[model samples]
Target: MNYVSKMLGAPDISVTLARAAARRVYGHSNRTNPRAVPTSHRYRVEEVPPALPRALFDTHFAPLTERLPSVTYEMQRYLRRAASLRLAELISGGTWRQCATALAIPENSARQTLNVLGRAFAPDSLWPIFENVVDHIAQELDESDARVDYVKRRRLMAQWHLPADHHYAMCQDLRKLRTLREQSNPSPIEVLVWSAVTEAEYLHSPILRALRLSAEGGGRSLTLSIHRLVRPTSPVGGSLRLRPTD
Candidate 1:
């Protein structure tokens, strides 16, 4: 799927252009020569509402843990083993910080433990829930320290149960969504909504019922078209070869 082909085929581009757009946004070396670059043309599509992103987050991303019981349970196991505390306690005020301070586990030791735990159990999908937890932890940290804390929590999650390349795929999806927004003339919020709904559908998320109802009330064809535009051709993380062999 080349960029031109994607632009021609659908009003909303797929990951190919998304990656290119990401490079354009984040990888450009010549900021002084902003005019040197060529921008994507706008397509006059249906207006995406401004409130879409918030609606999608509330509808799809927030309650992600509820859809994956097994993953949640595995997460609980790792949290307990790492902190010797329940999930609630780990999330409780000052407790996680205290645990981290008390253990003072070296990065190497933490990595090894995560690898061992990740290999101990195989779950169908882990990254989403892992990411959710990291975001949750980052919420408590200062903006300046949030990135550092996010990295630490991300490492812990990846070491514990995340499948290889899962994070990469997730990152690509985010970049793709951003790219799609840039290339199109839709509202930023609407682009987020499109990304969220398509992602929810791809994940078989619990919000499908809500989406279906929304579609039924609105128009079925529009929903179908939206799916065609942004839905991933491949599974988000590819094959989940989670279990390790001796």
Candidate 2:
């Protein structure tokens, strides 16, 4: 300090500071100190926020939910709200998990998500199909002379991934009421056989059959369905078993 005071007249000043002043006088102090933090550290690392895939959102998630616009729109709003909440939760910095958590969506759980999506993406409600079948099926068949169109039914059901099995079975029971009324001579106790022999022909079986492949493959493959806009039907035929191709 005494030597620096004598040299630069700045008593008790650091040698580096004294040198810095000398360099500044000649415009040479603009260079950073080697011992100091690097320029990289001065600039914070900025991360791009996680984005929901547009293709997946448009094709798989969006189109499937078109049938239930109100429900799906509400859900999307909730998810977006969840994402906003997660952003609020970030204290220091955000991570990928934080990003995913914000949207109330999981990451790297493809199989589970796809399975749920398969069920959630159902365009037609199985219960309604059953109800329709029960109410108008007899009339459509007997009075209206309309047979259960298996091709059209399969096409309709193929659009969904999951079939409401319990509900479909219940609808079958409702249909059997017609048969029960027509027994030739009612036995004291006759075993009521509710189409156990034709389990494949249930109302929702065709859709479940096609979607089994989708459910098994998880998120990798999407179900391929051909649909006609005909009114709902009392579906015929059994579970279709086919492998999705490459």
Candidate 3:
């Protein structure tokens, strides 16, 4: 019985010594080699501005009042003619490269022109008349595949580069224009016609002014007269006739 108790006590003593030695070694190692400790992150709190009134917010950011400046009509007509010419060039020639050369424009310029036309004559707008021109050109060409490919490529390019928010802003502007026109009690047709006219003027006024300035600076006098006639009663109604005189 005494020998068994001594054996048990010996094993316990060995375990206690082993634990003590391990503790000493660990403590010594920690003292000699301190590890890097991560610092706690600090955050800053900022005060936000007070919310603006809903009406004021809408007026400033998403205004529902769009007025067409007087020049848009002439600009629209010019753009339409230019669009038609571009489409004709694209369809008559097999390749845009040849068309660009014939038109004395760079390939990139031609592509940009087409992109602008596409946006201007969007399907949802009151420009379906121009769509027929595109359809005619597409049909006249034996290369339907080419037309489809061009559309796909153009769409991809637009998606990749065009600002998505600008379109939304334009839509908001249109809504505002409609609201303003309705409140004014003017016929929407007249408003649209006037808007189109103003759009042209807006585009051309700067050019015209620059031209006049150049003439003045060069010691040459210039006289310019523009007459615009709207024939709402003609067989082809709602047509704007522009005559420029020197």
User: Largest TM-score belongs to which candidate?
Assistant: 3
TM-score of 3: 0.23
lDDT of 3 by residue, 1-246 (tens): 333334323424453342223222211211211111111212100100011112222233211112222325333343433433334333342233344443323445445444544444333332333333433433433343322232232223322321335434433535533343344322222322322322222112222334446745421111111221231333121122221200
What lDDT tens digits, residue by residue, belong to model 2 across residues 1-246?
Answer: 334324544345553454344322211122211111112211111121122222223433333245554544335433222222222223223332343443323433222322333243344432223222222322222343322333333344343332245334433644432232233112101111111111111211333333455646421111112110011133232111111100
Residue 208 of model 1 has an lDDT of 30
Backbone clash pairs for candidate 2 read 82-102, 83-102, 200-238
* RMSD of each candidate relative to the true structure: 25.5, 26.5, 31.3
lDDT of each: 0.31, 0.27, 0.30
Backbone collision tally, model 1: 1
- What does the lDDT read for residue 122 in candidate 2? 41
- Decide which is better by lDDT, 1 or 3: 1
**What is the clash count of model 2?**
3
lDDT of 2: 0.27
Worst 10 residues of 2 by lDDT: 237-246
Instruction: Indicate the residue-level lDDT of 78 in model 2.
Output: 31
Stretches of model 2 off by over 4 angstroms after superposition: 1-49, 53-64, 69-74, 77-108, 123-246
Error of 2 at 131 (Å): 30
lDDT of 2 at 133: 26
Give the TM-score of each candidate.
Answer: 0.21, 0.15, 0.23
Candidate 1, residue 137: Cα displacement in angstroms equals: 2.0
